[model samples]
Target: MTVNDVKMILDACILCGEQYIGKEVHTACGADMMSDVLAFVKDQSVLLTGLCNPQVIRTAEMMDIVCIVFVRGKKPDEAMVALAEESGIVLLSTDHRMFTACGMLYEKGLHGGASD
Candidate 1:
């Protein structure tokens, strides 16, 4: 799905990287644990998380994630947004909780990436 598609599905507001809305993202992963995200996610371009920290952006950078959805109406602070903007990772916020957000995306055909 495209970033715009995900936004529509999640009713998310774009916080940064608006220009990347047309980008295609085949897989998604929803997790608040940065360690699980790092260990389990591979080629998952979209990250849905409730964690609103600079570490989330850093993890996205390390995992080459293209977009992040801060679920349950969570918003990152200025530094985190700046980091995501600098990393060219799109940031979106939604009212949906992590489970609902992930379920919505999954129902819309976005699946998790392969795990080793």
Candidate 2:
């Protein structure tokens, strides 16, 4: 699904990377574990997490993720937002919990990465 589609699906607010709203994301992974994200995610363009930190942006950078959805009303701090802006990653905030956000995206045809 496109980034705009994700925003619509999750009723999310754009935190940054407004220019990337039209980008397409084929896969999504929802997790708070950065290691799991780095190790298991492949070509996954979107990350859904409740963790709000600069490290989350770093993990997204490592995985080449283009979009990040902060679930459960979590908001990234200024540093995290600046980092994401610098890295050209789209940041979205949604009131839905991680599980609900993931399910919504999945129902809209966005799938998770392949399992090991």
Candidate 3:
């Protein structure tokens, strides 16, 4: 799926990187633990996380995640957004909780690479 597909399915708002809405996303991972995300390596490009911090952006950068969805209506501060912008990561916000958000996207055909 693609970022546009996710936004359409979840009715998410692209808080940043509106230009990347059309980017293709091969895989997604839902996690708040930065270490968990770092420990695994796959073709994951979409990160669905509730963790709001500068380190989240850095983790995404290191993982080459193309987009981030802040679930449970969580909002990152301006600094996080700036870091994401600098790293070219698309940011989105949604009311769906973490599990539900991950399930919805999974139901729509997005997977966390090889892991179930």
Instruction: Assess candidate 1 and give its lDDT.
Output: 0.91
lDDT of 1 by residue, 23-98 (tens): 9998898999999889777764799999888899999999999899999999999998899889999999999999
lDDT of 3 by residue, 2-103 (tens): 898988777788889888888899888889899988877355478898899998999999988989999988889998898889988999999999899999
Alpha-carbon RMSD, each predicted model: 1.5, 1.3, 1.1
Looking at model 2, residue 3 earns an lDDT score of 94
Model 3: lDDT equals 0.87
TM-score of each model, in listed order: 0.95, 0.95, 0.95
- Encode model 2's per-residue lDDT on 87-114: one tens digit a residue: 9999999999999999999888888866
User: Could you tell me which 10 consecutive residues in candidate 2 have the lowest summed lDDT?
Assistant: 107-116
User: lDDT for every model?
Assistant: 0.91, 0.91, 0.87
